[model samples]
Target: MAGGMPDRNFLVNVFQLVDKDRSGAIDSRELQSALSNGNWMPFNPDTVRLMIGMFDKKGSGTITFEEFGALWKYVTDWQQCFRSFDRDNSGNISKEELKTALTTFGYRFSDKFYDVLMRRFDRSGKGVIYFDDFIQCCIVLHTLTPEFRQLDRDQTGTATFTYEQFLLVLAKILH
Candidate 1:
């Protein structure tokens, strides 16, 4: 949601690619198919469900051109943010660069915490985070932050929550 509006043609093309059935809209199955086929970074079903709920303003259960345009812009913005923080153009961001970038963007966390985050996203064990993992990390972090904060009310930086709480959080994020 950070980039300028995407071009209509580009959105249309993306929509067409995802909407393999030519039904003029994309459903969960189609989206999963596209992701599985490597047209996307392979989001989880929960993420896909959340996205459809967020972008399908008409409550149609399928995404149209306007919805897809918004989705595309969101992805492009994330990509831009990732590229900006990558720094060395290595197609990955080192832990140091990630720390600096997050700090520049006003995030503050302990070095240990940052290392944990970086390790979680560094799937290749190469001490760097590629774009796909970065995207997943960002999405999961973004979706969970509010609920995490709500549960961690004492500012202890950690909290115990029930399975019910987890489901509630997931539902909130998806809806």
Candidate 2:
């Protein structure tokens, strides 16, 4: 379940990259759109398929909260992620703040998709979320995420992600 994202510090990089509005969390459609169309690059069907496979934990054709949590464990210790998203720094991200984060990423998407993305990521309904609790949300929007996974795929083969891999991925999206 460990998606094997980069180390803890890298988590912020992913956040900043997807935080198009500088808000913290990412919603599902934003993730989809981002994948379909990289912020600085173009979108690719192959990349999108690969991504859906990576985050689609429930196999219900959509990503669920628990699925997103599994990804959070990859780049950070949940406690730390939670602390940051706790907006008021109150140990939790409020629903408004959470929506803000998703909206920041999903503003380009349809109203309906955005709604589903937020509802799916903010499972507890506590109105707020911890960064650790929104892993899938973030990963779905990560430009470098697929390469990150490839690097960690020592299981199938020791295919470490190198600058070459980064270039290849960028080429596909950018071109």
Top TM-score prediction, candidate number: 1
Looking at model 1, the pairs that clash are none
- Candidate whose lDDT is highest: 1
Which digits, one per residue and each the tens of the lDDT, describe model 1 over residues 39-127? 23455555567667778899998988878888767667777787788788877788888888778765688999889988887776788
lDDT of 1: 0.75
Candidates' lDDT values, in order? 0.75, 0.50
TM-scores of the models, in the order given: 0.70, 0.30
Cand. 2 TM to true fold:
0.30
Q: Point out where model 1 deviates above 4 Å.
A: 27-62, 151-175
lDDT by residue (46-121, candidate 2, tens digit) is 4334444565665554444444444445334534544444567665566555556656554344566655666765
